[model samples]
Target: MIKLRASRRGDGAALFDVWYRAIVGSHDFLKPDDLATIVEMVQRDYFPSTQFTVAVDDADRPVGFIEVDGDSIGALFVDPDMQGRGVARALIAATMPTDRAWTVEVNEANSRARRFYEQLGCVLVGRRETDDLGLHYPLLRLEHSAAAV
Candidate 1:
C-alpha cells in the first residue's frame, strides 16, 4: 500500500532524483541553462526549507513528494514511473488542510499540471514571467480558496 509520511533528512538524495526525473519529463520548455540553474536552486534552497509530505510505497521508498510552506505548495513531483498512479494527488491531499486554502504555482507550459490543479478546484489567481526560482519560465499562480470549497 502507498502511504504518506514526513520527509527525513536522509531522503534528500532520493527525492532529488525523483524531482529531476519529473522535471526532465514534463518541463519541455526549459532551456538547458535555465534547467541547470533551477536544479541548483531546488537542491540548495527549496528542499531544505519546505515541509514535505512524501508518498512512500510499502517498502518505504518515496515515489512522490509535496513541498509546502504554510499554505503554499512550493513544488510537487512524482517519479516518472508513478506518474499516473495518483502519487501526486496522495501527496497533496496529505498536506492539505480542510479549513484552509492552499496555493500552487504551475508552469504555464505544462498543460498536464495545469489541468491537474484546475481539476482540484484551484483557480488561476495570477501569472508571472519567471518562476520563483528566478528562471525565465512563465508560471501560473493557482489558489484553492477556502470559500470556494
Candidate 2:
C-alpha cells in the first residue's frame, strides 16, 4: 500500500536524491549541473517540509513528494519506477487547499505534464520567460480558480 505523510527533517538528503534523479533521469529535462542546482535549492529553501507530503511505500520509504508555495504547486515528483501508479495524484490531492486557488508553471515541451494539469482543471493563463541559472525556458502559467483562469 502507498501512504502519504509530511516530510521529516532527516528526509532532506533522500528527497534531494529523488528530485535530482527525477529531473536528470528524464532525458528531456535539465543537464547534470542544472539538475544538481535545482535539487540543492529545493533541499535548502523550497522543500517546504511543513507543507509538503511524501508518498511512502509499505516499507515506509519515500517514493514521491509534493511541495506547495502559498497556493502554487511548486514541485511534484514521483520516483521513475513508481510513475503511473497514482503517487503523483495522491500527493497533489493532499496538498491542494480549499480557501484559495493554486498555480503551476509547466514547460511547453512537457506534454504529459501539461495534460496532467489540464485534467485537474488548470487552465493556461499566460506565458513567461524565466532567465534563471543562465538558461531561458518558456513557462506556461496554469491557474485553478475562475478568477485566476
Candidate 3:
C-alpha cells in the first residue's frame, strides 16, 4: 500500500526528478530560462529545507510528494507517469490537517493544476501578478477550508 512519510537526506535527486517531469508536463507557460532557474532553487533549497510529506510506493520509493509547511502547501508534485490515479488527492487528504484551513499557490497558466485543486475543494482566495520568484507568471492563491476536508 502507498503510505505517507517524511522525506530523508538522500531523497533530493529523486524528488527533483519527479518535480522536473511534473513541471515539464504541466507548466508550459514558464520560459525555458525561468524554468531552469526555478529548477536550481528547488533542488538546492526546497528539497533540503522542507520536510516533505512523501507518498511512497509498496517498496517505499517516493512516487509523489507534497510540502505542506504550516498553513501553506509550498509544493505538490506527483510523478507525471503516476498522475490521474489519486496520488495527488491522497497526498492532500493524508497530510492536510483537518482542524485548520490550508493554502496553496498555483500558476495562473496551469489550468490542469487549478482544476485539480478546485475539484479537491480548494477555492480561489487571492491572486498575484508574479510568482514567488518575481517572474511574470501570475499565481492564483487557493485555500481549502477545514470543514470541507
Candidate 4:
C-alpha cells in the first residue's frame, strides 16, 4: 500500500533521488546542463520552501512527493519504478485542497504529464515561454477545480 506523510528535513536527499529518477525518465529532452540547473533549484529552492507530502511504499520508503505552496502544487514527481502505480495521483490527492482551486505548471514538452493532469480535471489556463523558475522551457499553466481530484 502507498501512504502519505509530511516530509521532514532529512527526507531531502531521498526525495531528491526520487526527483532525479522521475525527471530523468520523463524529461528526456533536457540537456545535461539544464538537468544540472534543475537539480540545483529543486535542492536549493523548491524542496525547502514548499510543504511536501511524501508517498511511501509498504516499507515506508518514499516513492514520490508533491510540493504544495499556498493554493498551488509546485511540483509532483514519482520514482520511475513506481510510475503507473497511482503514486502521482495519490500524492496529488493527498495535498490538494477541496475548498478552493489549485494550480500547476506542466512542461509543454512533457505530454505525459500534461495528460495526467488533464485527466485529473486540470484545465489549461495559460502558457509561458519559460518554466516557473525562469528556465527556458515552454510551460502550460493548468488549474484544477475544487470539485475534481
TM-score of 2: 0.81
The 10-residue segment with the lowest total lDDT in model 3: 42-51
How far residue 80's Cα lies from its native spot in candidate 3, in Å, is 0.8
**Residue 18 C-alpha lDDT in model 4:** 94
For candidate 2, write residues 1-149 as lDDT tens digits.
89988889777776766776676555366556665676676677766444568999998888889888888887787788888899988887778765578898877666788888898788898887762454566778988884433
CA RMSD (A), model 4: 1.7
| Cα RMSD, each candidate | 1.6, 3.1, 1.2, 1.7
Per-candidate Cα lDDT values, in order, are: 0.87, 0.76, 0.89, 0.87
TM-score of each: 0.91, 0.81, 0.94, 0.90
Model 3: residues >4 Å from true position, as ranges? none
Best by lDDT: 3
Clashing pairs in 1: none
Query: Where in model 4 is the C-alpha error above 4 Å?
Result: 48-50, 147-149
Best-to-worst ranking by lDDT:
3, 4, 1, 2
lDDT tens digits, residue span 1-149, model 4: 99999998788888889988888888998878988988888789877776688999888888999888888887899999989999898887777788889999989999999999999899999999997667788999999988874
Q: Tell me the deviation in Å of residue 120 in model 3.
A: 1.2
Give per-residue CA lDDT, model 1, range 37-70, as digits (tens): 8888889987777668898899999889987878
List residue ranges in candidate 2 displaced over 4 A: 27-33, 39-51, 131-134, 146-149
